[model samples]
Target: MMWGSSEEYKAMFVEETNFYNRIILGWFLPPMMWENLPHFFQTWLRNYIGGVFLYLVSGFLWCFVIYYWKRNLYIPKDCIPTRKAMLMQICVAMKAMPWYTLLPTFSEYVIESGGTRCFPRINDIGVPAYVGYLLIYLLIVEFGIYWAHRELHDIKPLYKYLHSIHHIYNKQNTLSPFAGLAFHPLDGILQAIPHFFALFVVPIHFTTHIALIFLEALWTANIHDCIHGKIWPIMGAGYHTIHHTTYRHNYGHYTLLMDWMFGTLRDPTVDNDEPKKVC
Candidate 1:
């Protein structure tokens, strides 16, 4: 009923499933090669290979934009990290990749439990419903990550033991695409909980959920890249770059809505005039 007749839905699901499998697997392997792979190998490769490929691609693209374009050259040169520091940040990010991989499994468990629904086919739900669910998911995730992020700073024990590792890049330049994921594993997990929780709280199509994951990576990189500018209420690189320098404000991940509501929002343009040391 949520879609259509059982038979029609199943047929649509099968067609969409094949389409995704082809597109994903084809990214790394030629279609001719992937089509001939054993069933088990195909399944395993798609599961383990697909997400990581997308993550790496997304990170690389953002980093390229920042580095090649010198996107925020206007920022004081001293705030940028040295070449060695940038390398170290990338290494730390590599260390955290395994934790990122585990996140999807958590979402999968939620989906299997009937607590969440993810339609695999676009046709299964109309475009309007798909867009509506995506908006709701974004709102839920923004609210959740905002509080989780703020608590990571506000709570003394959490800050000292876990969140402080991320605060190391308390200035600009030292941040890179990888720096976005270079958190203490606990810190990364805590922030990611909202993303998983969104799946349970709303009906998100599988494709939309994948897009969210990619967006998370890209946005994280953009924020750390320290390009000063606001995208309306959504805090951009400028907002988060200031957060790194000041360490007490601009905690929202995607938007300033929660920060504005809670009075934690700090305008980057005003605050940048007098950057403070991380206390």
Candidate 2:
């Protein structure tokens, strides 16, 4: 909470010292304030401002490389995506900004506390802390994201209005990551729980938390976007592309373990049963 119209956010981000982390918890601050605002305000402001921030920073960098460096920007021809369309996706995601920010914070905290030290949040959590706090935090974040994502699908009315826009991308690309944020306002709130709950539930360090957030965003954005064929010869982005090809298959967000355990994984080698056009 850093910029709510209420006294709450202002005090934390602007009024308080070390406003970013101490008050709002670093990366977690912007989304929280965006979420807490009145729904109407959140919709317009969050999409326009937040979306532009994300798109411009990323787009400008990519455009720079493409234009100046003369490197081929790998966009799938079939994807038929445009800069404008991708930017619009940012507005689509604005609805889910709050939860997107908040829940991941909790997940990061738990992971940094040594939950899933196996994955390791770089060196920030430290080897010792990771070993001590790995399992519980990892399980909590995994289950939280899995079910939250699943619920978004199973709940029909909710999915039709909120989650459907994400599925609209027939072919995934840099724009693919923006797909998930098009949730209903209510769906956005639901997604925020994992982080808020983790705040009180888990004991975590700040650096570990920041590392976790970066990892989450990186993994997610990479899987959904940059990985076109496969990072590795045998296995890589193809695994996630299969999930996009058949939305029902890949529900787990972080690790591939959950989908394996639940038997929900769709093998990249297998032909899709009935591939639907991107809605």
Candidate 3:
């Protein structure tokens, strides 16, 4: 068989990639919960389980910080999402999560076979080139995501069939940290397509790529909270909240660079006129 075409290599990759998942699963699942499973199922299982872990942890952590530890800090008492709304968000996110993990699993398959322009070690390209490649990779993802998001709103059919599920939480009363991943499964995957696509266009570090993809779960949670982080250039929650309301602005992820370039950027100050208590 060709390289990475054997069951052994696939098993190896799944176990290696599940480093974090295995740690958590060790406590909950039986000693050999993963042993009898096929490699394909193991990969999907670890991904889905890891995603659920991240979702609950990040979503609740943000809720605690904003609504409990520091009540009325970023949003008013009346502005917080109701329990039912948050529950709907959680339900939608969990439903979409299984499908959302598929892309990363496919990405693992590609990386396992050396199918993309990925380098496992910084020594492969030196520190300077590694940093440069990282920047380039980010740019590709940013630009791709900007358009992918904008097109989702601009294209009537796409918005109606795929993206409107996310827009359901447009108002502050409905939006929350949990609403970040509260998307149609296809919608979430479509938006994340850029992160994977960048691997083909740039020499991305394999570990860095995987980390960024997972970090997105937390980042999205942060941006849906309606808190203006004031991290200029970065698209903070204030910007994203307005995007939800306006439906025609702030169509970039991670940064405002693309939104500014496309003239779709709107200042978050209008809605964030309240006290600026950012963390």
Candidate 4:
């Protein structure tokens, strides 16, 4: 009968779906390599390999803009922290490497769980699934990081040891962007822990993960250089500069939601006139 034949086809489709899920984790790595490798040869090749490559390319652009053009690239060397703060920033960035290493494994987990939907083949899942996955993943990740950043300041010893290096450059610049990565190893883990939840609970796309890392790094630089101790236009460096000026306010790391919701938003112009301090 026609009805009997249709039922058999449905059963076969379900079997194929389950079988494919088992191999989903394998797809994340190859794509990650393609997106992450080029920068290795530039800034990080000498020491950190990939990292040096990225930094060199980015730093070159940064230096040229500030040095030759005099365009007021947010970070002026004079604003960077001195002695101890600079040392702290360097050490902290080194410590954070272990967590950064875990990203690929986490990405695999997200895909398997249907926590993300930004993969190339995801279009096969239809537009509804793709859009839903993207929205949820972005919200969860942003919220998690915002809270984690806020907590870093609440704890005293940890703030001094791990997070302070970022503040060392009260005036943003190229060097200041990398300062946070030099946090203590523990700080690195703590900072990255939020991603674990997203990896485990969401179905994220491979491209989204790469995009997040790239955006995060670029954001760190932007907030330091572009905002340069001022607040403005919502998403730019101006907003982050307020955080540097008054550590207690502006707790949101990459978004305005947390600061607004948690009552930590600051108006930099109010009390931003003080002489800059070394982190």
The candidate that wins on lDDT is: 3
Q: Point out where model 2 deviates above 4 Å.
A: 1-56, 59-75, 78-80, 95-127, 173-177, 180-182, 185-189, 226-237, 270-279
Candidate lDDT (C-alpha), each? 0.70, 0.50, 0.83, 0.52
Best by TM-score: 3
Q: TM-score ranking from best to worst?
A: 3, 1, 4, 2
Looking at model 3, residue 72 earns an lDDT score of 93
Better of 2 and 3 by TM-score: 3
| Cα lDDT tens digits for candidate 3, 32-116 | 8775776556667777888898999989988998988998977888887899999999999998999999988889878776567
Candidate ranking under lDDT, highest first, comes to: 3, 1, 4, 2
* Model 1 accuracy (lDDT, Cα): 0.70
Worst 10 residues of 4 by lDDT: 39-48
Candidate 4 lDDT by residue in tens digits, 129-155: 767876777678667877777788888
Q: Model 4, 157: alpha-carbon shift in Å? A: 3.5
Off by over 4 Å in 4: 1-49, 73-99, 105-120, 171-175, 226-233, 269-279
What is the per-residue lDDT of model 1 for residues 162-246, given as tens digits with 9 covering 90 to 100? 8998888866657766678778877887898888877756777865675676567667877877766656877887788778877
lDDT of 2: 0.50
Model 3 lDDT on a 0 to 1 scale: 0.83
Give the C-alpha miss distance for residue 251 in model 1, angstroms. Answer: 0.8
Find the number of clashing residue pairs for candidate 3.
0
Please provide, for model 2 over 1-279, each residue's C-alpha lDDT reduced to its tens digit, 9 standing for 90 to 100.
111223342232222223333333334355566546643343334323443355446544544443346434454345434666666766755545654554443443333333322232235457676656645665676768777777787889767976666666646433455543444556655654554455444544434444454354335545555344533322244566666566677676666666777877765655556452222
